[model samples]
Target: MSIEYGEAQLLPGEKIAITTDTATEPFWKKAKERKLTACRCASCGHFRMPPTPYCPECQSREMSWPDLPGTATVFSFAICTRSPYSGEPLIYVPVVVDLDGAPGARLVSNLIGIKAEDVEIGMKVTVDWNPIQDDWLLPIFRPV
Candidate 1:
Protein backbone atom coordinates (compact mmCIF):
# COMPACT_ATOMS: atom_id res chain seq x y z
CA MET A 1 0.00 0.00 0.00
CA SER A 2 1.21 3.48 -0.84
CA ILE A 3 0.76 6.45 1.49
CA GLU A 4 1.37 9.91 0.08
CA TYR A 5 2.23 13.05 2.11
CA GLY A 6 4.51 16.06 2.15
CA GLU A 7 6.94 17.99 4.34
CA ALA A 8 5.13 20.52 6.50
CA GLN A 9 6.63 24.01 6.72
CA LEU A 10 5.01 25.30 9.93
CA LEU A 11 2.93 23.96 12.75
CA PRO A 12 -0.78 23.80 12.00
CA GLY A 13 -3.58 24.65 14.37
CA GLU A 14 -4.96 21.31 15.56
CA LYS A 15 -8.76 20.96 15.77
CA ILE A 16 -9.96 17.66 14.44
CA ALA A 17 -12.31 14.97 15.72
CA ILE A 18 -11.17 11.43 16.46
CA THR A 19 -13.22 8.27 16.81
CA THR A 20 -12.20 4.95 18.34
CA ASP A 21 -13.48 1.41 18.57
CA THR A 22 -12.72 -1.90 20.23
CA ALA A 23 -9.46 -2.41 18.36
CA THR A 24 -8.12 1.10 18.96
CA GLU A 25 -9.86 2.34 22.09
CA PRO A 26 -7.08 1.05 24.31
CA PHE A 27 -4.56 3.21 22.51
CA TRP A 28 -6.62 6.39 22.91
CA LYS A 29 -7.44 5.37 26.46
CA LYS A 30 -3.80 5.09 27.40
CA ALA A 31 -2.97 8.32 25.62
CA LYS A 32 -5.41 10.02 27.97
CA GLU A 33 -3.15 8.78 30.78
CA ARG A 34 -0.05 10.18 29.04
CA LYS A 35 1.22 6.73 28.22
CA LEU A 36 2.40 5.25 24.94
CA THR A 37 1.33 1.73 24.12
CA ALA A 38 1.35 -0.80 21.27
CA CYS A 39 -0.66 -3.90 20.62
CA ARG A 40 1.07 -7.22 21.21
CA CYS A 41 0.02 -10.69 20.27
CA ALA A 42 -0.86 -12.36 23.53
CA SER A 43 0.22 -15.74 22.19
CA CYS A 44 3.38 -14.70 20.37
CA GLY A 45 4.65 -11.47 21.95
CA HIS A 46 4.87 -9.78 18.59
CA PHE A 47 4.03 -6.08 18.52
CA ARG A 48 1.90 -4.22 16.01
CA MET A 49 0.82 -0.62 15.63
CA PRO A 50 -2.63 0.78 14.70
CA PRO A 51 -3.81 -2.17 16.77
CA THR A 52 -5.29 -4.90 14.66
CA PRO A 53 -7.99 -7.31 15.62
CA TYR A 54 -5.91 -10.34 14.70
CA CYS A 55 -2.19 -10.87 14.71
CA PRO A 56 -0.55 -11.40 11.34
CA GLU A 57 2.18 -13.59 12.76
CA CYS A 58 0.02 -15.86 14.87
CA GLN A 59 -3.57 -15.09 13.78
CA SER A 60 -4.56 -14.73 17.40
CA ARG A 61 -7.39 -12.42 18.30
CA GLU A 62 -6.05 -12.11 21.80
CA MET A 63 -3.89 -9.04 22.33
CA SER A 64 -2.02 -7.22 25.02
CA TRP A 65 -0.96 -3.61 25.31
CA PRO A 66 2.42 -2.80 26.77
CA ASP A 67 3.54 0.66 27.72
CA LEU A 68 6.30 2.07 25.54
CA PRO A 69 9.18 4.36 26.43
CA GLY A 70 7.66 7.28 24.50
CA THR A 71 10.80 7.27 22.39
CA ALA A 72 11.19 6.35 18.72
CA THR A 73 13.31 6.70 15.62
CA VAL A 74 12.06 8.45 12.52
CA PHE A 75 11.64 5.76 9.93
CA SER A 76 10.22 8.18 7.37
CA PHE A 77 8.66 11.65 7.32
CA ALA A 78 7.31 14.56 5.32
CA ILE A 79 7.18 18.33 5.67
CA CYS A 80 4.04 19.74 4.16
CA THR A 81 2.47 23.13 3.70
CA ARG A 82 -1.08 21.87 3.92
CA SER A 83 -3.11 20.14 6.56
CA PRO A 84 -3.85 16.53 5.69
CA TYR A 85 -7.32 16.76 7.13
CA SER A 86 -8.55 20.23 6.27
CA GLY A 87 -6.65 20.96 3.05
CA GLU A 88 -5.94 24.46 4.28
CA PRO A 89 -2.48 25.95 4.16
CA LEU A 90 -0.61 24.83 7.27
CA ILE A 91 2.72 23.45 8.34
CA TYR A 92 3.26 20.10 10.06
CA VAL A 93 5.64 17.19 9.83
CA PRO A 94 4.03 13.85 9.30
CA VAL A 95 6.23 10.99 10.36
CA VAL A 96 6.35 7.25 10.54
CA VAL A 97 8.44 6.27 13.53
CA ASP A 98 9.79 2.95 14.65
CA LEU A 99 8.81 2.42 18.24
CA ASP A 100 11.83 2.25 20.55
CA GLY A 101 10.83 -0.81 22.60
CA ALA A 102 8.36 -2.46 20.27
CA PRO A 103 10.14 -4.19 17.48
CA GLY A 104 8.38 -4.06 14.12
CA ALA A 105 5.83 -1.58 15.43
CA ARG A 106 5.77 1.90 13.99
CA LEU A 107 3.41 4.83 14.51
CA VAL A 108 2.26 7.47 12.03
CA SER A 109 2.36 10.72 13.93
CA ASN A 110 3.31 14.35 13.44
CA LEU A 111 6.73 15.75 14.32
CA ILE A 112 7.15 19.09 16.03
CA GLY A 113 9.82 20.99 18.00
CA ILE A 114 12.20 20.77 15.04
CA LYS A 115 12.56 22.49 11.73
CA ALA A 116 11.42 20.73 8.59
CA GLU A 117 14.78 20.92 6.81
CA ASP A 118 16.56 19.37 9.79
CA VAL A 119 14.37 16.27 10.06
CA GLU A 120 16.09 13.11 8.89
CA ILE A 121 15.87 9.39 9.00
CA GLY A 122 17.21 7.80 12.18
CA MET A 123 16.49 10.93 14.21
CA LYS A 124 15.65 10.20 17.86
CA VAL A 125 12.43 11.64 19.23
CA THR A 126 10.09 11.53 22.21
CA VAL A 127 6.33 11.75 22.39
CA ASP A 128 4.34 14.89 23.23
CA TRP A 129 0.58 15.11 23.54
CA ASN A 130 -1.70 17.23 21.34
CA PRO A 131 -5.09 17.87 22.85
CA ILE A 132 -7.79 17.51 20.26
CA GLN A 133 -11.58 17.26 20.27
CA ASP A 134 -13.39 15.22 22.92
CA ASP A 135 -10.63 15.60 25.50
CA TRP A 136 -8.46 13.12 23.60
CA LEU A 137 -4.78 13.58 22.99
CA LEU A 138 -2.97 12.89 19.77
CA PRO A 139 0.55 11.52 19.95
CA ILE A 140 3.07 13.75 18.26
CA PHE A 141 6.85 13.68 18.46
CA ARG A 142 9.72 16.04 19.03
CA PRO A 143 13.49 15.82 18.92
CA VAL A 144 14.80 13.92 21.93
Candidate 2:
Protein backbone atom coordinates (compact mmCIF):
# COMPACT_ATOMS: atom_id res chain seq x y z
CA MET A 1 0.00 0.00 0.00
CA SER A 2 1.14 3.52 -0.73
CA ILE A 3 1.31 6.25 1.88
CA GLU A 4 -1.07 9.16 1.76
CA TYR A 5 0.35 12.45 0.48
CA GLY A 6 -1.01 15.88 1.17
CA GLU A 7 -2.42 18.09 -1.54
CA ALA A 8 0.54 20.48 -1.24
CA GLN A 9 4.24 19.97 -0.82
CA LEU A 10 5.03 23.44 0.43
CA LEU A 11 3.88 23.81 3.98
CA PRO A 12 1.54 26.64 4.93
CA GLY A 13 4.16 29.32 5.53
CA GLU A 14 6.75 28.31 2.99
CA LYS A 15 7.50 29.99 -0.33
CA ILE A 16 9.43 29.11 -3.47
CA ALA A 17 12.22 31.24 -4.88
CA ILE A 18 13.46 31.48 -8.45
CA THR A 19 16.21 33.02 -10.53
CA THR A 20 15.92 34.03 -14.19
CA ASP A 21 18.31 35.31 -16.85
CA THR A 22 18.08 36.96 -20.26
CA ALA A 23 17.15 33.91 -22.31
CA THR A 24 14.61 32.56 -19.81
CA GLU A 25 13.25 35.86 -18.49
CA PRO A 26 10.53 36.22 -21.08
CA PHE A 27 8.83 33.02 -20.04
CA TRP A 28 9.04 33.93 -16.34
CA LYS A 29 7.78 37.43 -17.02
CA LYS A 30 4.73 36.06 -18.76
CA ALA A 31 4.16 33.63 -15.94
CA LYS A 32 4.31 36.46 -13.42
CA GLU A 33 1.47 38.12 -15.29
CA ARG A 34 -0.65 34.94 -15.22
CA LYS A 35 0.10 34.08 -18.79
CA LEU A 36 1.71 30.89 -20.07
CA THR A 37 4.12 31.05 -22.98
CA ALA A 38 6.63 28.89 -24.81
CA CYS A 39 9.67 29.98 -26.73
CA ARG A 40 9.27 29.46 -30.46
CA CYS A 41 11.77 29.60 -33.27
CA ALA A 42 10.89 32.61 -35.39
CA SER A 43 12.34 31.06 -38.49
CA CYS A 44 11.57 27.35 -38.26
CA GLY A 45 8.63 27.53 -35.81
CA HIS A 46 9.95 25.03 -33.30
CA PHE A 47 9.25 25.20 -29.56
CA ARG A 48 11.76 24.87 -26.75
CA MET A 49 11.59 25.25 -23.00
CA PRO A 50 14.25 26.68 -20.66
CA PRO A 51 14.49 29.19 -23.44
CA THR A 52 17.80 29.43 -25.19
CA PRO A 53 19.19 32.20 -27.39
CA TYR A 54 19.45 30.36 -30.67
CA CYS A 55 17.16 27.93 -32.39
CA PRO A 56 18.57 24.44 -32.70
CA GLU A 57 16.55 23.93 -35.85
CA CYS A 58 17.89 26.62 -38.19
CA GLN A 59 20.71 28.25 -36.24
CA SER A 60 18.81 31.51 -35.83
CA ARG A 61 18.68 33.90 -32.89
CA GLU A 62 15.17 35.02 -33.87
CA MET A 63 12.49 33.76 -31.52
CA SER A 64 8.91 34.44 -30.51
CA TRP A 65 6.79 34.10 -27.39
CA PRO A 66 3.27 32.84 -27.72
CA ASP A 67 0.71 32.13 -25.04
CA LEU A 68 -0.23 28.50 -24.60
CA PRO A 69 -3.57 26.79 -24.06
CA GLY A 70 -2.65 26.20 -20.40
CA THR A 71 -3.34 22.52 -20.74
CA ALA A 72 -0.94 19.60 -20.81
CA THR A 73 -0.58 15.84 -20.86
CA VAL A 74 1.26 14.03 -18.10
CA PHE A 75 4.26 12.68 -20.00
CA SER A 76 5.96 11.30 -16.89
CA PHE A 77 5.90 11.74 -13.10
CA ALA A 78 7.25 10.67 -9.75
CA ILE A 79 5.63 10.47 -6.31
CA CYS A 80 7.59 11.95 -3.46
CA THR A 81 7.00 11.03 0.17
CA ARG A 82 9.41 13.42 1.85
CA SER A 83 10.42 17.03 1.54
CA PRO A 84 13.89 17.48 0.11
CA TYR A 85 14.40 20.54 2.26
CA SER A 86 13.03 19.64 5.68
CA GLY A 87 13.19 15.88 5.47
CA GLU A 88 9.73 15.84 6.95
CA PRO A 89 6.85 13.79 5.68
CA LEU A 90 5.20 15.42 2.70
CA ILE A 91 3.69 14.26 -0.51
CA TYR A 92 3.73 15.97 -3.88
CA VAL A 93 3.92 14.89 -7.48
CA PRO A 94 6.68 16.11 -9.79
CA VAL A 95 5.75 15.88 -13.44
CA VAL A 96 7.14 16.35 -16.90
CA VAL A 97 4.30 17.55 -19.10
CA ASP A 98 3.77 17.99 -22.81
CA LEU A 99 2.36 21.47 -23.20
CA ASP A 100 -0.57 22.18 -25.44
CA GLY A 101 0.07 24.46 -28.42
CA ALA A 102 3.78 23.85 -27.97
CA PRO A 103 4.82 20.87 -30.00
CA GLY A 104 8.01 19.13 -28.82
CA ALA A 105 8.30 21.24 -25.66
CA ARG A 106 7.95 19.71 -22.22
CA LEU A 107 7.95 21.55 -18.88
CA VAL A 108 8.87 20.23 -15.49
CA SER A 109 6.41 21.34 -12.84
CA ASN A 110 4.31 20.08 -9.96
CA LEU A 111 0.89 18.51 -10.00
CA ILE A 112 -1.66 19.55 -7.40
CA GLY A 113 -5.40 19.22 -6.57
CA ILE A 114 -5.36 15.43 -6.91
CA LYS A 115 -4.33 12.45 -4.89
CA ALA A 116 -0.98 10.90 -5.60
CA GLU A 117 -2.33 7.51 -6.56
CA ASP A 118 -4.63 8.99 -9.18
CA VAL A 119 -1.86 10.62 -11.20
CA GLU A 120 -1.31 8.69 -14.40
CA ILE A 121 0.80 8.98 -17.51
CA GLY A 122 -1.19 10.75 -20.21
CA MET A 123 -3.63 12.33 -17.76
CA LYS A 124 -4.99 15.68 -18.82
CA VAL A 125 -4.21 18.72 -16.68
CA THR A 126 -4.52 22.49 -16.74
CA VAL A 127 -2.40 25.24 -15.29
CA ASP A 128 -2.88 26.76 -11.84
CA TRP A 129 -0.61 29.34 -10.29
CA ASN A 130 1.00 29.40 -6.87
CA PRO A 131 2.65 32.51 -5.54
CA ILE A 132 6.38 32.42 -5.12
CA GLN A 133 9.08 34.77 -3.84
CA ASP A 134 9.38 38.30 -5.24
CA ASP A 135 5.74 38.38 -6.27
CA TRP A 136 6.24 35.76 -8.94
CA LEU A 137 3.93 32.89 -9.86
CA LEU A 138 4.53 29.22 -10.31
CA PRO A 139 2.61 27.06 -12.77
CA ILE A 140 1.25 24.02 -11.07
CA PHE A 141 -1.38 21.83 -12.68
CA ARG A 142 -4.77 20.41 -11.85
CA PRO A 143 -6.97 17.78 -13.45
CA VAL A 144 -8.60 19.12 -16.54
Candidate 3:
Protein backbone atom coordinates (compact mmCIF):
# COMPACT_ATOMS: atom_id res chain seq x y z
CA MET A 1 0.00 0.00 0.00
CA SER A 2 1.47 3.30 -1.16
CA ILE A 3 0.51 6.55 0.54
CA GLU A 4 1.56 9.73 -1.18
CA TYR A 5 1.36 12.55 1.32
CA GLY A 6 3.15 15.13 -0.78
CA GLU A 7 6.21 16.18 1.30
CA ALA A 8 4.73 14.71 4.51
CA GLN A 9 6.21 11.24 4.23
CA LEU A 10 7.94 11.16 7.58
CA LEU A 11 5.99 10.21 10.67
CA PRO A 12 5.40 12.70 13.46
CA GLY A 13 5.81 12.48 17.27
CA GLU A 14 8.51 11.09 19.52
CA LYS A 15 8.55 7.37 20.45
CA ILE A 16 9.11 5.97 23.89
CA ALA A 17 9.01 2.68 25.84
CA ILE A 18 6.24 1.69 28.25
CA THR A 19 7.15 0.82 31.79
CA THR A 20 5.92 1.11 35.35
CA ASP A 21 8.04 4.22 35.69
CA THR A 22 6.45 5.78 32.61
CA ALA A 23 3.47 3.99 31.13
CA THR A 24 3.66 5.02 27.47
CA GLU A 25 6.54 7.37 26.80
CA PRO A 26 9.25 4.99 25.60
CA PHE A 27 6.69 2.92 23.72
CA TRP A 28 6.16 5.64 21.16
CA LYS A 29 9.87 6.40 21.20
CA LYS A 30 10.69 2.86 20.13
CA ALA A 31 7.96 2.96 17.50
CA LYS A 32 9.28 6.24 16.13
CA GLU A 33 12.49 4.41 15.36
CA ARG A 34 10.72 1.65 13.38
CA LYS A 35 11.53 -1.28 15.68
CA LEU A 36 9.00 -3.51 17.43
CA THR A 37 10.19 -4.60 20.85
CA ALA A 38 8.41 -6.87 23.29
CA CYS A 39 8.75 -7.40 26.98
CA ARG A 40 9.87 -10.84 28.26
CA CYS A 41 9.45 -12.26 31.70
CA ALA A 42 12.71 -12.99 33.46
CA SER A 43 11.27 -15.96 35.29
CA CYS A 44 8.86 -17.70 32.92
CA GLY A 45 10.46 -16.28 29.74
CA HIS A 46 7.09 -15.50 28.20
CA PHE A 47 6.94 -12.74 25.60
CA ARG A 48 4.43 -9.97 25.95
CA MET A 49 3.30 -7.47 23.39
CA PRO A 50 2.68 -3.79 24.24
CA PRO A 51 5.43 -4.09 26.82
CA THR A 52 4.28 -4.36 30.38
CA PRO A 53 5.94 -4.00 33.76
CA TYR A 54 4.65 -7.37 34.93
CA CYS A 55 4.43 -10.65 33.08
CA PRO A 56 0.94 -11.80 32.34
CA GLU A 57 1.97 -15.46 32.28
CA CYS A 58 3.97 -15.98 35.46
CA GLN A 59 2.85 -12.78 37.16
CA SER A 60 6.40 -11.59 37.40
CA ARG A 61 7.20 -7.91 37.44
CA GLU A 62 10.65 -8.44 35.95
CA MET A 63 10.84 -7.98 32.20
CA SER A 64 13.25 -7.00 29.46
CA TRP A 65 13.00 -5.87 25.86
CA PRO A 66 14.22 -8.17 23.11
CA ASP A 67 14.65 -7.87 19.37
CA LEU A 68 12.24 -10.06 17.47
CA PRO A 69 12.34 -11.26 13.87
CA GLY A 70 10.27 -8.99 11.62
CA THR A 71 9.17 -11.43 8.92
CA ALA A 72 5.44 -12.02 8.58
CA THR A 73 2.45 -12.54 6.25
CA VAL A 74 -0.81 -10.82 5.35
CA PHE A 75 -2.90 -12.50 8.05
CA SER A 76 -5.49 -9.80 7.40
CA PHE A 77 -5.70 -6.35 5.80
CA ALA A 78 -7.95 -3.58 4.53
CA ILE A 79 -7.73 -1.10 1.66
CA CYS A 80 -8.22 2.47 2.91
CA THR A 81 -8.88 4.91 0.13
CA ARG A 82 -9.99 7.81 2.31
CA SER A 83 -8.08 9.61 5.01
CA PRO A 84 -8.54 12.66 7.27
CA TYR A 85 -4.98 13.70 6.53
CA SER A 86 -5.31 16.24 3.72
CA GLY A 87 -7.99 14.14 2.07
CA GLU A 88 -5.38 12.37 -0.01
CA PRO A 89 -6.00 8.82 -1.18
CA LEU A 90 -3.93 6.43 0.89
CA ILE A 91 -3.81 2.67 0.62
CA TYR A 92 -3.45 1.42 4.16
CA VAL A 93 -2.72 -2.25 4.72
CA PRO A 94 -2.76 -3.41 8.32
CA VAL A 95 -0.75 -6.62 8.58
CA VAL A 96 -0.17 -9.05 11.39
CA VAL A 97 3.46 -10.14 11.18
CA ASP A 98 4.60 -13.31 12.88
CA LEU A 99 8.14 -13.23 14.07
CA ASP A 100 10.57 -15.94 12.94
CA GLY A 101 12.04 -16.64 16.40
CA ALA A 102 8.98 -15.92 18.50
CA PRO A 103 6.39 -18.40 17.36
CA GLY A 104 2.73 -17.37 17.75
CA ALA A 105 3.95 -13.83 18.27
CA ARG A 106 2.62 -11.16 15.96
CA LEU A 107 2.47 -7.37 15.57
CA VAL A 108 0.50 -4.90 13.46
CA SER A 109 2.07 -2.40 11.10
CA ASN A 110 1.21 -0.56 7.93
CA LEU A 111 2.51 -1.86 4.57
CA ILE A 112 3.58 0.75 2.04
CA GLY A 113 5.10 1.23 -1.44
CA ILE A 114 2.98 -1.62 -2.83
CA LYS A 115 -0.25 -1.66 -4.77
CA ALA A 116 -3.52 -2.61 -3.13
CA GLU A 117 -4.43 -5.13 -5.86
CA ASP A 118 -1.03 -6.80 -5.60
CA VAL A 119 -1.47 -7.61 -1.93
CA GLU A 120 -2.59 -11.17 -1.19
CA ILE A 121 -3.37 -13.24 1.84
CA GLY A 122 -0.54 -15.41 3.14
CA MET A 123 1.94 -13.58 0.96
CA LYS A 124 5.54 -13.74 2.17
CA VAL A 125 6.82 -10.46 3.50
CA THR A 126 9.82 -8.97 5.31
CA VAL A 127 10.37 -6.14 7.75
CA ASP A 128 12.21 -2.88 7.14
CA TRP A 129 13.34 -0.36 9.73
CA ASN A 130 12.41 3.33 9.76
CA PRO A 131 15.10 5.47 11.38
CA ILE A 132 13.08 8.27 12.90
CA GLN A 133 15.21 8.30 16.04
CA ASP A 134 18.79 7.43 16.87
CA ASP A 135 18.00 4.93 19.62
CA TRP A 136 15.42 2.76 17.77
CA LEU A 137 14.15 1.64 14.40
CA LEU A 138 10.45 0.95 13.71
CA PRO A 139 9.76 -2.27 11.79
CA ILE A 140 7.81 -1.85 8.58
CA PHE A 141 6.83 -4.71 6.26
CA ARG A 142 7.28 -4.95 2.51
CA PRO A 143 6.97 -7.66 -0.17
CA VAL A 144 9.70 -10.24 -0.42
Name the candidate that leads on lDDT. Answer: 2
Error of 2 at 52 (Å): 0.8
TM-scores for all candidates: the values are 0.88, 0.92, 0.67
lDDT of 3 at 131: 49
lDDT of 2 by residue, 23-105 (tens): 88889899988888999999999998879999988888898999999999999999988877778788888899999999999
lDDT of each: 0.86, 0.86, 0.60
| Candidate 2 local lDDT, residue 128 | 86
Summarize candidate 1's per-residue lDDT along 1-144 as a digit string, tens digits. 633333434333356678898999999999999999999999999998889899999899998988999999999997787667679877678899999889999999989887677789999999998888788888889899
Which of candidates 1 and 2 is the stronger one according to lDDT? 2
Residue 58, candidate 2: how far off, in angstroms?
Answer: 0.9
Candidate 2's TM-score? 0.92
Task: State how far residue 130 of model 1 sits from its true place (Å).
Answer: 0.0
Question: Runs in model 2 with CA error above 4 Å?
Answer: 1-14
Q: What are the clashing pairs of model 2?
A: none
**Runs of candidate 3 exceeding 4 Å displacement:** 1-36, 131-137
